[model samples]
Target: MPIWVTEWALIDWFAGPDYPDSARQGEYAEASAAMMEELSIVERYAWFSLPYWDHIPSLGLYHPGPVATPAGEAYARAGG
Candidate 1:
């Protein structure tokens, strides 16, 4: 059974009220790099489930709801 981490949970954990919108603004470079290393380490031996493939927008991302977000921006850039 794959335990998928929900986008809502990630946003709540990383982009929470405690985290200033500006402060956590980045690709989270170090963390992303570590994840790559960890993924390579556990590619064969299972340790934990992978994260959700798609990302969801936070409350801030949508002003009134269902608006533009960086995720949406990236998606558009990708010709999504």
Candidate 2:
């Protein structure tokens, strides 16, 4: 199974909260698509399963709840 875990403090250390939302979305889309593509390949084919996504929005990490982020949308498209 694939999973994406996010730690706010770790992200803050590398890139402050000031990081552009657009840039983050772009990166999220790229990452989500890459993961999906990898999982879709015959060489990498495996049982399909919804990716486990963990992030605490209260702590600043993106949440795939009420509001869907690019990552969440991509995951949905991948049949999550």
Candidate 3:
């Protein structure tokens, strides 16, 4: 048998300049309650991705502390 793991990121890179990419993503996450609710079909290890210690761009869920990123909030609300 084999096992698979996955993580997702809600990027807002295309949002207007007024909002930073992460901020835009946070806004989306606050509004993706429904979408988050529907992402409970994880048959294996599935979760949201976030920054990490030392600012390394790796598959992580924390960036030195409690991350309130839109995507993270959504993932938490959605039972991730």
TM-score per candidate, chains pooled: 0.29, 0.33, 0.40
Specify the highest-TM-score model's number: 3
Query: What residue pairs are clashing in model 2?
Result: none
Provide backbone clash counts, one per model: 0, 0, 1
The best-first sequence of candidates by TM-score reads 3, 2, 1
**lDDT, model 3, position 25:** 52
Worst 10 residues of 1 by lDDT: 44-53
Better of 2 and 3 by TM-score: 3
Best by lDDT: 3
Alpha-carbon lDDT, every model = 0.31, 0.40, 0.49
Estimate, for each residue in 1-80, the C-alpha lDDT of model 2 and write its tens digit. Answer: 55543221113445444333534643555565556566633223222122324432322223444555554454446554
**Model 3, stretches more than 4 Å misplaced?**
1-5, 11-20, 27-45, 53-61
lDDT of 1: 0.31
User: 1-80, model 3: which lDDT tens digit per residue?
Assistant: 44434554453346641333555555555555455454555245455455552542333444566655555665566655
Off by over 4 Å in 2: 1-12, 16-23, 39-65
Q: State candidate 3's TM-score.
A: 0.40
Instruction: Report residue 20 deviation for candidate 2 (angstroms).
Output: 4.1
